[model samples]
Target: MRIATGGIAQETNTFQREPTTLADFERPGFGVVARGEEILDLEGTGTVYGGVVAEAKALGVELVPTTYGGVMPGGRVARSAFDTLRDEILVALRAALPVDGVLLVLHGAMALEDHDDGEGLLLDAVRDLVGPDVPIVAPLDLHTNLSDAMMAGADAFVGYKEYPHVDMPRTGARALQILAATVRGQARPVMAHARLPLIAPNQSMVTTWQSPLKIAIDRAREIEREPGVLAATVLGGFPFADVPFAGVATIVVTDDDPPLARRLADELATICWDRRAEFAVRPVPVDDAIAEAMAAPPGSVYVLADIADSGASGTAGDGTVILAGLIAAGARSAAVAQIMDREAVAACIAAGVGSTVTLAIGGRHDNLHGPPVRVTGAVRSIHEGGFALAGPMGAGTRSSRGRTVVLEIGGPGGIEVQLTEVRGHPHDLNYFRAFGIEPTERRILVLKSAAHFRAAFEPIATKVIEVDAPGISSANLANFDYRALRRPIHPLDAGARWSPGA
Candidate 1:
C-alpha cells in the first residue's frame, strides 16, 4: 500500500497583530522550508514529515513525498499563502493518485485570512479528490478545534494523548495502524463528534491534573475496548482560535457502530459539562508568584509559567511581567528559557562567555505584554542550541534554540537565563539539555508556556506555580477584545447558559 503524508500546522490567534507568512514558516533552524514547487523527499529529522517517514519505514509502507510547511503560531495565515500551500498539496495528491491512503499531520486549529475552518476546507478538498472509498486518516494535536465538516471528510482521526505532545510519533503510528486495519478489511470506520458548551481556558486544560479531562479521557479509553471500537479521541479544542466551533470537542471512531460512538461522545461531553467549574484556573499575580518562589525552602525548584505569552498557542515568547516581578523581588537561582530576543543574543555572543553585559531582554516584539526588562548579566555559554526530545510531547523530534546564549544575572547563588531567536515552546527535557543546563539542578525554572510544560517538567519540579504574566494568549480571555468570536461562549457571556446536545 502506498501512503502520502504531509503537514501544515499552526494555531492561529485571530487577535494577534502579525501575519503568518511563508517566511514565518521558514524561521531559521526552527521550521521547515518548502515552497510551492518543491517535491520534498522525506528525511528523518525532528519535523512532521520526519516522524511520518520513520513510522512508514517501520510499517514498511511505500511513502509518497509532499511539501510540508509549518509556521509558529500567530495571526491568520495569509489567504494567498494558505491557498498556495493547499493547492500545492492537492496537486501532489492528484499526481500521486491511486494511493491506498492519505495521512495528514495537522494542527487542526489553523485559521486562514478569509476562512475560520482551514482544516475543514483542506479535508473537503482531499475528499473531493479521493472519493468516498479511500481511507483518510489524520493525526492531530490534542488542542484541535474540531468541526463537523472535518469529521465528515476523514475516515478516522487520532490525537496526541499527552498535551506537551510527547506522543507525536505514537499518534502517527496509531493513524497508520488504523489505515492498515481498514485496508485489511478488519474494521469499517464511522465517526461521531460532540461539541461541549464549556470552552476550557488554555492554562486550566493541563492533562496532568485530575480534572474532567482526566476523567473524560479515561472514560473514552475504557469505552474503546467495547466491540467494534477502533479509536477514541478527546479534543481539548484550541480556544484561542476565534471561530464559531472553537470549543471542547470529543471524537470517536468505531467499526459499524454509529450509535455506540454517539453514546460515547455524549458520555464524554456530559463529563466536561459536569466539571466545567473545576477547569477554571485563577492565575496568581506575577509579584505573588515571585514572592512565593523566593520564599520556598532552599534547594527546591519552583516552576512559574507565563500563561499569556505561551509559545504553545503561538504567542511571541517575549513577555516582561514575570521577569519584572522576579527582579523586583530579588529572586535568586532562577532561570527562564528562550526569551526570543535576537539583539540580546547577538550582544551576549559578542561579549563572550563570562563577560559582563547589560541589555534589554524580552517585551520588545509584544508590547501588549508589558515593557522590556533591563538586566546586567555575564554571558555563561554560547552554542548552536539543538537537541532531540525524548518526552511524550516532542519525543524523537529535533528542535533548536537557534544561536543561543545563557546569561547569568544577579543572584547570590547564581541564576541563569536562556535567550534564543526561535519562537517555539519548550515541550521536553531536551529544551534545557540543548544549553547544557540541567532542569532538575535549578532552584527555579520559569517557562513561557501555558500547560505543556507540566508533562515534561513536572517530574523535576518541587512545586509548580502559574503566574499571570502578560501576552497575547492571556488566560483572562475577556481581556481580548475579540470581534470575530461568537458571543455567549463560556466566561465571555457569564449570564447566558448553554445546554449540552443543543
Candidate 2:
C-alpha cells in the first residue's frame, strides 16, 4: 500500500496587522518547505512528518511524500502565499497518483487573507483529487478551530492532546496507524464533530497536570479505549484567529460506528462546555507579578509569563507593558526574553557592541500592547539570531529571530533585554543561552509566551507568574475588536448557550 502525505500548516492570528507573505515561509529558521524525497530527512525528527514516516516504515507501506510548508503562527496568510503552497502540495500529490490513503500534517487553525478555513479548503482540494474511496486522515494541533468543511473533506482527524504540543509525533503516528488500518480493509473509520460556542484563552488551556483542559482530555482518552473507538480529539480552538468557527471542538472516530462516534463527540463537547467557566481565568496584575518576582530569593529564577505578548499565539512580540513595569520598579537581576523592534536592533547594530545607544523600544506593531519606552543601554552583543531547539518540543528543529542585538538596560549586569528584528518564542532555555544569557543564574526571567514556556522553563523556575498585559493575544477576549467572529460566543456574550443539536 502507498500513502501520500504532507500539508501546509500555520496558525493565524487575524488581529495581527501584518500579512504573512511568501518570504516568511522561505525563511530558514522559523519556516520550512520540504518537497518529495527531501521530506525523508525528517524521518527521525520530532515533527508530525517524523511520526508519519516512522509509522509508514513499520506498517510496510510505500510513503509518497508531497509538499509540506510550515511557517510561524502570525497574521492572515497572503492569498498569493497560500495559493503557492496549496498548488505545490496539489502538484506533488497529483504526480503520486493512486495512493492507498493520505495522511496530512495540518495546523487546523490556519487562515488566509481570503479564506477563514485554510486547512478545510486544502483538504477539500485533496479530497477532490483522491476521491471518496481513499481514506484521508489528518493530525491537527490541539488549538484547531474545527470547521465543517474540514469534517466533510477528511475521513478522520487526530489532534494533539497535549497543550505544549509535546505529543505531536505521537499524534502523527496515531493518524497514520489509523489510516493504515482503513487502507488495509481492517477497519472503516467514521468521524463525528461537535463545535461549542466557547473560546478559552490559550493560557487557560494549558494541559499541565490536572488543568481544566486536562480533565476534558482525560475523559476523551477514556472514551478512546472503548470498543470500536479509533480515536478521540478535543481541540480548545484558537480564540485569537477571529474566525467564525473560533471555538472549542471535539471529534470522535470509530470503526463503522457513526452513532457511537456522534455520541462520544457530543459527550466530550458537553463536558468541555460545562466546565467553560473554569477556563475564564484572569492573570495576576502586572505590578503584583513584578513585585513578586523582585521579592523572590536571589539564587533561583522567577518567570513572568507575558501572555498578552506571546509570540506563540501570533503577537508581534513587541509589547512593553511588562518591560515598562519592570523598569519602573527599578528591578535588578531581571531579563526580558525579547522585544521585536527592527529600528532598535538596527540602531544597536550600528552603534556596535560596547557602545551606548538610546532608543525607543517595542509597542510599534499594535497599539493595544502599549506605547514604546525609551531606554539607553550599551550594546552587549549582536548575533545572527539562529538557534537549535534543545528542549523536548521540536528538539531537532532550528529557529531564528533575524539579527538579535542584546542591550544591557541599567549596566553590565543589570536588566538585559534582547531586541530582535523578528518575533521569537523564548519557551526554550537555548533562546536565551544562545545570546549569552544564563537562565539559571538570573533571578527573574520575563518571557513573551503563554503556556508553552512551562514545558522548558517551569522545571527550573522557583515560581511562574502569569502577568496580565494588553495585546491581541490577551486572555481578556473583550479587549479585542472582533468583527469576523461568530456572535453569541461564550465570555464575549454571557447569554451564549450550546447543546448537542443547537
TM-score of each: 0.91, 0.98
- How many angstroms is residue 18 displaced in model 2 relative to the true structure, after the best TM-score fit? 0.7
In model 2, what are the clashing residue pairs, if there are any? Answer: none
Q: Model 1's lDDT to the true fold?
A: 0.77
Candidate 1: count the clashes: 7
Give the C-alpha miss distance for residue 458 in model 2, angstroms: 0.6
How would you encode candidate 2's per-residue C-alpha lDDT over 195-228 as one tens digit per residue?
9988889877798767677888999999989999
Could you give the C-alpha RMSD of every candidate to the true structure, in order shown? 2.8, 1.0
Q: Which stretches of candidate 1 lie over 4 Å from their true place?
A: 33-60, 350-352, 495-500
Error of 2 at 151 (Å): 0.4
Instruction: List clashing residue pairs in candidate 1.
Output: 46-398, 164-393, 165-393, 166-392, 166-393, 166-394, 167-392
